[model samples]
Target: MRRLLSTTLGQILAIIGCSSVATFLLFIVLLSYFGSPPAPPWPWQNAYRVAGLVESLRGAPQDVRNTIVAAVRRPDLSVRLTSSPSACSRQTLDTHDFDAALRAELPGITDLAVRACTSHKPGETIQVLVPLDGQTLEILTDRTSGEPGRFTGPFYSALIFLCVGVAAMSAWAISRVIRPLRQLSEQADAFGREMSIAPIEEHGPLEVRRAAHAFNLMQERIMHSVQNRTRMLAAISHDLRTPLTRMRLHIETHRTDIVPDKLIQNIDIMQSMITSALAFLASDTDRETREWLDLGALISTLCDEYAEGGAAIRYDGPEQIRFFCRPEAIRRVLTNLVDNALHFGRTVTVSAKVLDGAIQVDVSDDGPGIPEDRLRDVIEPFVRLDHARNDRPGSMGLGLSIVKEIVQAHNGTLRLINRHPSGLTARVSFS
Candidate 1:
């Protein structure tokens, strides 16, 4: 029930409940206003009592009729009682009783009541005329004076029917009021799923329309910025390749002595750096067509190539561990880490572990662990700790930086920790 009340139907019911209570209270007040008598002394019931000084009073015994009349004259009083000594007289007046007696008459009462002013004296036998046929009295008691009063029956009936109609209309009005808001909620969910839901039409109330307009503008701006950045990266990568090709050709024709050999090595390093940088930048902007590749086989091939060249590299993990990744980009990142490990520590250990929806690759070597404060600085582009650089050769300081960038592009994290056996542990996690 609590959950139901939180839904749209419950909102409609809430509005109806409140409105019905208010309307019912108002109807009570209105009925009271209509039932009130015009005169004073407050005719809350059918009868009223007023005291006046005795006028000329009259009285009579039962056998003989006597005459008596009231001395006071008030045009508005429906019945006037005049008292005379020894006799009393009665005469017809107005029809206040018919209206007063309405509450006692349930179901149907179509008569207007008559008022008879009676005159009598105290301590005397009073004689008054009584109708013989009882026809005049009956007609007067049920005359139904003016137009029939409907406040007790038809008026309330109409009010109840009208109120029910209004409640139904109000429910529809509430649904109409919230329809735009529901659409906004659906659009937000779609955006979470695709980040590309079309903006809703600006309609409904002021607040809703403004929200729709703002969302549309934000979507357009994000799409524009992403397109512009991807285009700029593509242009830069295209322009860098021409100069790289020329440098490779120029170094190839004259690289034989030690100086030439060093230049060619530097150029080769520069070419590899450019290629990896381009791959990292292009990964997210243009998703690669994925294929099945044995991760263990890939790692083994690299380790074997380095082993044949006399590097202390070993693949110490599952022989057939397979995973999907952008092959060229991931290869470059792994290659950079393994090369850095072997260069600095002279021995590299490669291992893989699967934990909690992610694959972790740990590359550790028994060189000097990095200083704790310089861990963050080493991942910055072109940043080399002076001590680490002086301890090693062929280190351009870009290897770990490139590794971090490539891991980030795969929506992964890279961490550098000091190994327990006195080496740096580089853990790369791919999800």
Candidate 2:
């Protein structure tokens, strides 16, 4: 219920309802103050006039009564001599206004009363009583002479139509505002999944357009920075390769007895590191197009390749599960995570499953897991925990870093957690 009220539709409805009620009440107050200019005299005024005429004719002769009755009688109104009071019920009468008007118009008359009663027709009729010297005179008037204490049918119908029209207009204006915000949110989500998404259209109200414009500018700046960094890395790689090549040629020319094997191995390691660094940096300069692929099959293929190489790698997942992603990038990420697991553990397990609208892939190993404190630090580029953990040859520590970047590019998350009793588990999840 709270969430429902917080929505845009709920707020708009609340505003419309409150405003309509307030405006209706304000209109009633104004009408009462100024009064209905076009409306005829109220029921009380008509009753008072008839009562005054009757009071003046009190104690007059029968001839005088007949003459006055003939003058005052009409199709909708009549005055008559009666020995009993009016038969109409007093419950529905507006006695306050009726008695006040009667007192103002005929101060000498007392024991006055007024009532509204149903007639043979569809509408109500007013009954006014005035006591004479020894008899009671009755006055009956048309329905229009009494106020019903409620708005007329037409008035209520018009009020309803006004409220509905105003509500529709409010909904339209609110939708216009909310539509742009919804578009902006969708664009942001797309950019998170793929940085190459087109810029958001600068439209709608001023605030929305300004936000879109700012987002586009920020995206351009980030792309520019990435491009600049990739170019610098490429230049550095080219400049260093020439000197390394020269040193290699010079070593080959020297005698083997003087130049140790370990020294040559060191130079080869440096070349391999340079190559890996260049590859990693170059990946940032290119955009990978995403496509739907079988994620389970990809993981199974990686497991098969490793098994063929005599590694204890097993896959536990469905036969095929399709997902949209950059195939090559995801493949590289899975390969690196599997290789890293194999390096520390004798047995490596790769598994995939769909959970909560997302795809989760887990790579687990039976080796000693990384320390809890160093879990976050190990994913940083060139970060090595060789001093604390087993030192593997030719490991530059770029594997996990690359995996993190690829997973993030797909709007996914990667987490490394120590397994119970022993080993480590690396889990990646993406929607």
User: Which runs of model 1 end up more than 4 angstroms from their true locations?
Assistant: 1-105, 110-273, 276-286, 289-293, 322-329, 355-358, 390-398, 405-412, 420-422
Write the residue-wise lDDT of candidate 1 on 205-242 in tens digits.
Answer: 89888887887787776765565456545644554565
TM-score of each: 0.44, 0.44
- Model 2 TM-score is 0.44
- What C-alpha lDDT values do all the predictions have? 0.60, 0.75
Superposed model 2: Cα runs more than 4 Å off: 1-264, 284-286, 391-394
In terms of lDDT, model 1 sits at 0.60
lDDT of 2 by residue, 146-194 (tens): 4544567788778777877888888888888878778888988887787
On lDDT, the leading prediction is 2
**On a 0 to 100 scale, what is the lDDT of residue 320 in model 2?**
90
